[model samples]
Target: MPVSKRWTVEVLIGEDHGNTSAVARLDTNDGTHLVGAGQARLNPADDDIPAIGDELAAARALSDLGHRLLLTAAADVAAVAEQPVHLTW
Candidate 1:
């Protein structure tokens, strides 16, 4: 049986105004490219701008990871259904 795998690439960018954004790309062997891109605006409540930026970046990264995992699981299921099975005794 042939094995299929998923690859994910993520990028996090921070703006000068304490805003952070993330872009995630998920690639699978079945020629599927899933994208999960988002932006996070930090609230300057009591935290400093730098601290807010860090928190926003972390939150964005988690969001990207969650999206990528969902896409990968979906791709795996689809690939399994489409792949041919061969058995040898």
Candidate 2:
């Protein structure tokens, strides 16, 4: 039998004082919730580009979320295997 599952991630972004920030959140069916945050700062000598900032912040947030998920999976695997586990992307 094949088992199927669906997961979703929501990203929220905000900009303030030439700084951009983002948060990525994941909610799993097993009632597991994970969150990751990221930030980007605009240099005074550079032009203000809102889109770039948004992209950077969102990308970082997603990266952070991915790292967390990897760690969680490693822990779960270690628990089942009765040994320490290291997972990599």
Quick one: best TM-score, which candidate?
2
Query: Please, what are the lDDT tens digits per residue for candidate 1 over residues 17-87?
Result: 65666666656576766565666675666555665565566566667666666666666676788964333
lDDT score, candidate 1, position 37: 61
Each prediction's TM-score versus the true structure: 0.47, 0.92
Task: Give the per-residue lDDT digits (tens) of candidate 2, residues 1-89.
Answer: 77687678999999998999999999988888999999999999999999999999999999999999999999999999999998989
TM-score of 1: 0.47
Q: What is the lDDT, from 0 to 100, of the residue 55 in candidate 1?
A: 59
Candidate 2 TM-score versus the reference: 0.92
Which structure among the candidates has the greatest lDDT? 2
What's the lDDT for candidate 1?
A: 0.62
What are the lDDT scores of the predictions, listed in order? 0.62, 0.94
